[model samples]
Target: MRGIRSLNHLPKRCYAAARRSEALTVPLAGIKPSSATPLPPQNVQVSKLPNGLVVASLENYSPTASVGVFVRAGSRHETVENQGVSHVLRLAANLTSKGASAFKLCRGMEALGGSLSVTSSRETMVYTADCLRDNLGTLLEHLVNVTAAQEFRPWEVSDLTPRVKIDKALAQQCPQIGVIEKLHEAAYKNALSNSLYCPDYMVDHVSSDMLQSFVKDNFTTGRMALVGLGVDHSVLRQVAEGLLSERSGAGAPVAKALYRGGELRVQNNEALVHALIASEGGVTGSAEANAFTVLQRVLGAGPHVKRGSNITSKLSQGIAKATAQPFDATAFNASYSDSGLFGVYTISQADSAGEVIKAAIAQVSGVAEGTVSEADITRAKNQVKADYLMSLESSETLLEEIGAQVLATAAYQLPDSVLQAIDAVTQDDVVKAAKKFVDGKKTMASSGHLTNTPFVDEV
Candidate 1:
């Protein structure tokens, strides 16, 4: 299973050549051959059990499998009092399994040679198991036990309390994660986006009784999506039917929520100043959202520290006053249910922090004004399209892509169609996306040595 982290081992000379070309020329326009791209995925099968849980499957010949139990209960669903319940739910899933004690649950999975993990985002909470196909049953049985009937014991909650608090503190110290949290806070400060990771205060508030109530409210059959990759969905469905069909609770609220934007700065002890500049972008369905993705690739893709292209140079210059040591910058196009975050982040020396932000803003402004040449668009499109296609080579990524599409939209869409749509975007579309920030309101969060300098004022 080749990964983006692995493909990064290509020769330095290749990156050097790419870096040398600064003239925003569209080399792909006339040279690269254009033909219809065959959709790589065979197809996806989606069905619902009598209990209302979605069962999705995609087959791969690989000897490995990835099984996930996805629930539409996460940070976005929390009120101020229940802020970190989503995180607690994810953690609790790992500690106990169906009618089994925590110790037994851990030992069973370890004996089966399986890896169990869980993560939460704004929209969903996922519990995953990755292992050889031979151990699929053992894994699924344990997963069903944990998700559907685990007991949130008092001792278990007490033991995990300190660990969760430590994690919260660690998140605050890391510049990259801190900046992202801040940017999201700026965009949806009072709603789901603002409090994706429950604060320590919220974690302390999560008693054993609270865990049971939280799980009862959120982890319901009606609000769940069961995803199995590289394994038979029908087999999983038959085996797990009794467990997931148990009635638990209703679906989450689907009404529109409000979000506001402004500067949100949090000072922390780190050498570099980390800045996350964020602006609202369209959600997944809009044409503007697709265009913004292309824009993100052009400016944020590839290894800037090692590849060092013109776009990277602009970022480096922006953060020049901070530190002489090299740092990284990335533009993230994170999609939420109602809106998106077109964010750019930089880790640079604290001294040049203000200059770095100004330079980044200028670069964004230039792209919005259509200063980017056709070549930039062509190369960016190809890079994004090719990378996205290549990701499907692995069963894990393939499954994630399928599930993500289904989660974002009700129907399954081919990745090639998505690529084609991205390729169709012109410089004008890119400019429009860039204008969402350059000429519109923006939000930001910064940590590290940022007290002496401030971000450029928006007019």
Candidate 2:
């Protein structure tokens, strides 16, 4: 009887093993498919609230959601008396708010697997929150508190001094950062001249009152945009109207950035020299700016491949011919709402810095003299279009692009329109852009051994 029972169990086990050996692609023996329909794709929707808050969102049907509040209270808005307030404000994002304690904000986000962060530039500040689609509401509550209801306790604000110093110290480690900061300082008379990092004198001196005043002046609905990705437009609009409407009217007058070209040099003992020479180029969203974008690519905008030689870059090729010494060169283009900067950035051995700088400038001059070919123009335009499209593929970048456009123009521009603008750039346009840079007032900033670096007027 025992042997018979053993044989029966063996057969059952063999049958179960055989069933499990079926191909994964094959349907299971007893599962039914659901009849639910998938959600349709939606385009970006934008609306402006009566209070002047711009609300934009897209329902991409993604499992994760990202929302951002873009405010026009960047470092550019800092007054002479409150320089570096924006830097301190960025670090104070997680401080105790009117609605949530600092600890609660941290623990709440951790519980929901979400994150909140703040980033500021010369023109805008962005507060972004990310979480699963199901937990968006909870995340938004924290986002609102952080962006609008900040308490900015004195103790918490004081505690940020060490972090501020750390930020400056880290920036000091990179010559590129110091050069860029110095360039901005020399490029503008006001507004855009403010440094992103806290100044040494203002690191521990940014008072709570200063932060509050800056917020009151720049966080108004007139200067804010609420943007979202993988979320409903109606939901975002409701939040904009109901929660972020307290600062309804235009909060303060904005001063336009005045460009006054100049130069600043930092002498150091390093053997390598980093230099940037620029001239006024084009304003953001203009046809001239598109031309400059193409011109930048034609000259060279860094290497496309990771750790690959920039053999195709005109700057690199020209500079290589100028000297056998190891050097790096790339065209730099930055467009802002009111003004722009276009130029070349080069790093070379101290003895060859002057030659490298001159060669890079000659490359631009060659483009201005129409030495470039139609093929080069075509390639550059393609690069510009590809970069623009690829940047929007990431959700974070997409949200930022949307927020920037909406905040700047109170509207959103589709990627197709942007590509069309790039496509409209002609070879003549590229040459003209190069000519403008060659003739416009120049601003330069350089660091490292000054043994061979040319002065701005000399270059």
- Predicted structure with the largest TM-score when compared to the true one: 2
Q: Write the per-residue lDDT of candidate 2 for residues 154-184, one digit (tens) a residue.
A: 9999999999999999999999999988999
lDDT of 1 by residue, 80-197 (tens): 6667877777677766544677888888878988888887887777788888888888888888887888688778776777778777877766667877887777667556464656
- Report lDDT (Cα) of residue 397, candidate 1: 72
What are the runs in model 2 whose C-alpha is more than 4 Å off? 1-36
Where model 1 places Cα greater than 4 Å from the true spot, the runs are 1-42, 248-250, 268-271, 302-328, 455-459
Itemize residue pairs with steric clashes in candidate 2.
Answer: none
Overall lDDT per candidate, in order of appearance = 0.72, 0.92
Q: Which candidate number would show the highest lDDT if scored against the true structure?
A: 2
lDDT of 2: 0.92
lDDT of 2 at 153: 93
